[model samples]
Target: MITHIQGRLVEKNPTDVVIDCNGVGYLLNISLHTFSQIPDEESLKLFAYLIVREDSHTLYGFSSVAEREIFKLLISVNGIGASTARTMLSSITPQQVKEAIAHEDVALIQSIKGIGAKTAARVILDLKDKVLKVYDLDENEVSVNKNNTNKDEALSALEVLGFSKKQSERVLDKLLSEQPDANVETLIKDALKKL
Candidate 1:
């Protein structure tokens, strides 16, 4: 288990980086989020997780321990491999991943490029409690008002106004998450600007 690596950054790419630690240059797979956080010059440190299989040994690195923990949790779910976990992390920030699992927001999880509805639901079902516990988020933080119709109404209005359902839903979800008590009109207006 390579917990972390601290060394001079020899190479930097969107999906990977090479770090020169002592005399060895270690190549680490990284998500876009981590890639964005890494600087192009001098010394750097990344929290790392190594995966060993029958054929290959791979090392994935994250900009923060929190992201690494989320990656580990994501891969622990059945049917979610390291690559899928990386894709998930790459598709969204670690915090968003936590929020999706904690809130059981299947649609938000499914919106990721490779994840489907079933996988999204499975992720929520398998990890929601763990996410809550790991993040120290209580039920109150995870629970959304079941009677909240503002999001639904805003989505319907956006659809009627010719916005795509999926896009509208994503935008509306973001708006509602930012402003939980926003009215339909406010959501619609904010969503329109984002859409």
Candidate 2:
């Protein structure tokens, strides 16, 4: 297993990079996230994962170990391939992917270019627990981050009182921005006035 490569950066591109270690040059496939993180310097180091098949060996590199771990987990899914995993990583940040899975946000996952509803659901179903466990994320915390627990509570209250979700969100966003420490009561009150 080519765990990592550290050497002179011989070439850099959006989808791949060539690193020269000693006299050998190694080509590593990479996602756009990794591409952006690659520094414009002579020396480079990248955590790597090697996929060996009967016909060939391919190496994928990541800017951080976290990204690499996420990549490995994604590729472990039944229907997701290395290329698909790379595409998912490139389409969104690793943190976003983790949050989406933890929250079971099928729509967010399906929004990716090549993912379908079934695949998105399968991803959430198969990986939700694993992601939460591996990332040390609590489901409650994930939901809180996704909707901001206080804001969500306020929004729900407003909606029950006949306020539109869009309107409620707008007002709540503004209130939260101005006073981030605002509690649910304050958000609901301010939002009612605005609405």
Candidate 3:
């Protein structure tokens, strides 16, 4: 298994980035959070998870070890896939997810695009205790109360699709900064480019 990749960030896309390691270029699908932290034309290092299927082999990258751990927990759910787990991280921070699970807030999880009430409940039931134990963070510390959900609702939508909040916010900010009234889908597309 490939534990991590370190090299020049030659290219970046919404769901992936290509890192040039010596003469070889490694393409890694990464979360929006990790995407935002990456700088163009610079050497980068990402903690990684290798997913092998009967038909394909893919590498998923994370900004931190903690985020990678969260991804593992998310994929362990019966119906969750890597894409869904990535979406969950894009919508909510690892800290927010940990807190939501600790408090068993199924509503928060359900709010994400592909997640339903039943799946949301399952996420809380199966991993709440485990996440709490792993992160050593209280529910209050990770609460979603501070976010401006009204302004962030569009971003919340993109995040569910696996674009990080930072990436979403930056793209949205720029779109609005110029047009000042771009619609949801336009903002999403614009933000996708930066991601």
| Per-residue alpha-carbon lDDT of candidate 3 for residues 1-195, written as tens digits (9 for 90 to 100) | 888999988888978988898989988888887777676658899899999999999999998998999999999999999999999988888877877777666657877889986898788889977886776767676453323222355677787998776777777666767765666666667777777
lDDT per residue for candidate 1 within 101-182, as digits (tens), equals: 8877665687788897679879988998898887899888666743144665676688789999888888877777777888
Instruction: Rank candidates by lDDT, best first.
Output: 2, 1, 3
lDDT: worst 10-residue window of model 1:
144-153
Superior by TM-score: candidate 1 or candidate 2:
1
Candidate 2 residue-wise lDDT, 23-136, digit = tens: 899999999999999999999999999999899899999999999999998898889999999999889988888888897766567768899868987888889889989878
Error (Å) of candidate 1 at residue 142 is 1.6
Model 1's TM-score against the true structure: 0.79
**Which portions of model 2 show Cα errors greater than 4 Å?**
143-195
What is the alpha-carbon RMSD of candidate 1 to the true structure? Answer: 5.2
Q: What is the C-alpha RMSD of each candidate to the true structure, in Å?
A: 5.2, 6.1, 11.8
TM-scores across all candidates? 0.79, 0.74, 0.69
Which has the better TM-score: candidate 1, or candidate 3?
1
Off by over 4 Å in 1: 145-163, 167-195
- Of the two candidates 1 and 3, the one with more favorable lDDT, higher being better, is 1
